[model samples]
Target chain A: SQKIEQNSEALNIQEGKTATLTCNYTNYSPAYLQWYRQDPGRGPVFLLLIRENEKEKRKERLKVTFDTTLKQSLFHITASQPADSATYLCAYNAGNMFTFGGGTRLMVKP
Target chain B: NAGVTQTPKFRVLKTGQSMTLLCAQDMNHEYMYWYRQDPGMGLRLIHYSVGEGTTAKGEVPDGYNVSRLKKQNFLLGLESAAPSQTSVYFCASRSQGTGELFFGEGSRLTVL
Candidate 1:
């Protein structure tokens, strides 16, 4: 079975600092990987998607890097603010199926 | 536009009772999914349909059933509700050739 391991269950970071989250997977090679942000009482919103062939993708203050060799993906939020606090989920797209990691909760303190 | 809509935003059921959650999408997406969100468990896939009349089991399909009779509508059924089934349910749709999933607000189900 494919397993996705996220760095931590929860992380606390100071505002304006860069927050980095890690996701590592094993036993499967995904065609693409996706990142999502989910606030409390809400469904997850898509943040970014990086294909296996793509090294990195960026949008605004968010950046995602996919390393197929290490079977890992890193998500970074630069100059983070309190509003950036939420649970982040990483998903692996194995052909027609999609699997999600447990998610990491991030708290940005002002 | 209402990208994806889930009916019965909140529902409560006694053990062994049965009910269904409705999900509709206006985007004409070919793939529809049913997922359950539990505290600390992220989201678990229940069942999904690649197209109308096609349903496939997902990671956590044991206690749930799904049907996609129309391209825009997908239904999830709980034959015998259990306390373990108490969780927020989300419906999502995706167009072919895209990796992004548009999700409904979600249905909060509480099985007592």
Candidate 2:
């Protein structure tokens, strides 16, 4: 069985700083991984997706890196703002199965 | 365009009660899924459908049943609700090749 693990602790960062979150998997490498932003009382919204063949992908101020050798994916939000505070989740697709991590709550303080 | 819509935004059910959660999508997607979210736990897949009239069990399919008779609607049912079934349910749909899921607002269910 594949397992996705994310830091359960809340990450606090000063506004305008870079926030990095980690997602580790224990099992076979997935074909692709995705990051989602979930605000309180709302469903998750897709932020970025990186394939196994790709080392990194960027969308505006958001970037995601997938390291198959390390079995980890790192999500970085550059120049983060107060409005960027939300729970970030990482999910992967392996064997056509999608599994999600527990998610890391990000708090960007002004 | 109502990408994915879930009915009964909030529901309260007693133990042994039965109810169904409705999910509708207008994007003409080929894949649909049902997941439940709990505190300290990430979203757990309950059931999924690859296409109309096809359904398969996901990671956590216990205590739930699903039907996808139509291409645009997927139904999740609880034959006998239990306290452990209390959680937020989300419905999602995605196209064939995109692999990006479009989720509904969510349906919060409480069982006592």
Candidate 3:
């Protein structure tokens, strides 16, 4: 069975500071990884996707890096705002199969 | 556009009760999936469909059955539910190649 692990359960950062979260996988080499934002009581919203061939991807204030060798992916939210607080999930995809991490709840405080 | 919608946003089911969760997508996607989210355990795939009339079991498919007779709708059924089945269910759809999933608001189920 494939396992996805997020390094932290929760992360707190001062507003305007960069927040970084990690996702590590074991026993699989996914072709691509995805990142999503999930608010309390709400389903997750897709944020970004990085392919195995691609090392990094960025969108607005968000960036994701995939290291197939390390079996890890790092998600970063730059110039974080209070509104950026939410649980972020990392997912890996193999063919049509998908696996998700437990997610890291991020809190950006002013 | 109502990318994806799940019916019965919340429900409480007694043990052994049976119910179906409906998922509808107007995006005309080719793939649909059902997932359950529990505390500290992200979303686990229960079942998924690659296309109409095709369904497959996912990582956590036990105690659940799914049907996708229509391209736009996928139904997840809980036959004889149990307390351990309590979790927030989400229905999602994605186009053929994008890999970007559009999720519904989620259906919260509490089994007693």
Best by lDDT: 2
**Against the true two-chain complex, what DockQ does each candidate achieve?**
0.75, 0.81, 0.85
Ranking by DockQ: 3, 2, 1
Candidate with best TM-score: 2
Q: Looking at candidate 1, what is the lDDT of residue A61?
A: 100
Write the residue-wise lDDT of candidate 2 on A1-110 in tens digits: 78899999999999999999999999888889999999988989988989999999999999999999999999999999999999999998765557899999999999
Model 2: per-residue lDDT, tens digit, B5-107? 9999999999999999999999999899999999998999999999999999999999999999999999999999999999999999976777888889999
Candidate 3 lDDT, tens digit per residue, A1-110?
A: 67889966579999999999999999877888999999998889999999989999999999999888898999999999999999999998767867889899999999
Which window of 10 residues has the lowest lDDT sum in candidate 2 chain A? A91-100
Show where candidate 3 strays beyond 4 Å.
Answer: none
Kindly report which residue pairs in candidate 2 clash with one another: none
State the TM-score for model 1: 0.96
State the TM-score for model 3. Answer: 0.97
All candidates' chain B TM-scores are 0.97, 0.98, 0.98
Docking quality tier of candidate 3? high
Model 2, residue A4: what's the lDDT?
94
Candidate 1 per-residue lDDT over residues B1-112, each given as its tens digit: 9899999999999999999999999998999899998877878899999999999998899989888899999999999999999999999998676779888989999999
